[model samples]
Target: MYRWPFISVVLIIAILLVLAFVLNLSIGEVWLNPFQLFFSENLQSAILISEFRLPRAIAAVLVGSALSLSGLMMQTLFRNPIAGPYVLGISSGSVLGVSLVILGGSIFSAEFLSSNSAIIIAALVGGLAMMFILLMVLKIIKDIMTLLIVGMMFGAFATSVSSILQYFSPGFQVKAFVLWTFGSLSKVDYPQIYWMISFIVLALFFVVLSLKGLNLLTLGTSQLEQFGIKTKRLHFIILLATALLTSSVTAFCGPIGFIGVIVPHISKKILKTSNHWRLMPVSMMIGAFIMLVSEMLTHLPGSGMVLPINSVTAFIGIPFILWILFKPLKNEI
Candidate 1:
């Protein structure tokens, strides 16, 4: 499988992430000289690095990993080359939960502190609840395409409900909800990064350990059963993993999309095999790189207007999905 090349690609992606991290620490509306970030007395630069750049950079990398891994697992589970984090409406559910907090938060402004934890807790509840519903639907439907459609419809329903809520919301509350839907890596601060990092690390450790099972599944259901694989148990495990990672990103970074969907396709094409061992880590690196690239696009210096990270990601993810749909191979990874 040319393991050396796979490792080389990951190393190169990691190096690129380091470079982006340094560059991200430097650039801002008040440009800090790259050299001056370290070599000069620019306290403003130091503060920017500590406050804005560092958190955003860390969030970019973490969100990217989470989304990418979730997508990879979904594709493997659904046997759909294009399945991503969005396929299950998990992120939309999280969005709905956030909307509840934003719109209704001011109703208790005298006790806003109580609402902060409520917001995140509500998001987790929404996401896991949706996941549970999807699992039950999958059991009944027994058709992959049907399950996919059900997820889409469920997400649409959540969005509709959220829209109705926003209609009656205060102006600032609506505005806050809108911005949160668009997705932003810069919004995550230092206080939250520790939990985000710790959770993602632990989740990914289990996911990576499942690589062997994932690899075996690529041989098809008959082989997997022959190998004593409990199809339903594994199914739930992967879905739970997907839910955990997706919920984490949606909770913290507001549903950063595309990394989970398209990076796995790119990984499959690059690795030229369905083995999870090769695809998993590579997908993680590619996801992070794509995120760094999109983050730069969002803050492009000359544009005079910042673009949403979703804008750039949709551009990348949509094309890959369309390509997969319009022209497919008998064995799609």
Candidate 2:
């Protein structure tokens, strides 16, 4: 096995993360100097930092780390490089949930379900429903590839249902659904961020416990079984953990993409290691850095206009994905 410069890589990533964090905090609609954030006497700047930018920045870090780790687990479990956190249809499930609330509420005149909190709840329920279905399927089918296919089918089914809802929805309702699909970190307030972070942290605990199993799984099922690992049970635990992490982020952030799909590969490329212990934390940090960069780009700095976070992520993700597809040693990455 090749040796990786783990310490050096970690230090570099930490520096990047710190820089991204400062830039994310400082450059917004109303730019504030980095020093002003801590010591400025202006009350409005303090409010903006605490009330608005802080929550969004925290959300970016939490959501990015959660999705990236989830993606790494899915890739390990399925032994598929293209497999992502949303590959299990949890995000589509979230979309379906949001669609029902946003579109359905419009049609039914149900004002209660139209609120931000209600929509987040609906998204969580929808995602968990699909996760439950996947768990049931996992019990019936032991083959990993087949389960991956089934998950895709479920995602397609959820998407179709959401499209039907959109078709029946009025213009304003359709617009609302469209905007939600675009993804936003700003919508998450401090209270929502607290719960989101809590769930992600809990899910991460399960992931940490399974780190040894994840390393074995990377060597293939036979190797895993040779170690007396119950692949099915391990798979269940990882899937559940992935579901919890991915679904919570999707519920609150509205299915932000590319972090899960791209960040793990980036970590592998930089760290030059397949070991989960190194890969997991590096991926989390890289994910956070990328998300902070994405958030900064969305602000457009001097333009006073913000781009959709989803668009920014896609722009960054798509190129890396293409590189992976076209690389001579694609499978190795």
Candidate 2 off by > 4 Å: 1-4, 328-333
- Candidate 2 lDDT over residue span 74-168, tens digit each: 98888778889999899988999999999989888885778898889999999999899999998988577888899899999989998998898
lDDT, model 1, position 39: 72
What's the CA error at residue 80 for candidate 1, in Å?
1.2
Evaluated at residue 89, the lDDT of candidate 2 is: 93
Which candidate's lDDT is highest?
2
Q: After superposition, how far is residue 249 of candidate 1 from its true place, in Å?
A: 0.5
Give TM per candidate.
Answer: 0.87, 0.96
- Tens digits of per-residue lDDT, candidate 1, 157-239, equal 99998888788777877877788778887767877788777768777766866777788777666245578776656666777
* Alpha-carbon lDDT of model 1: 0.77
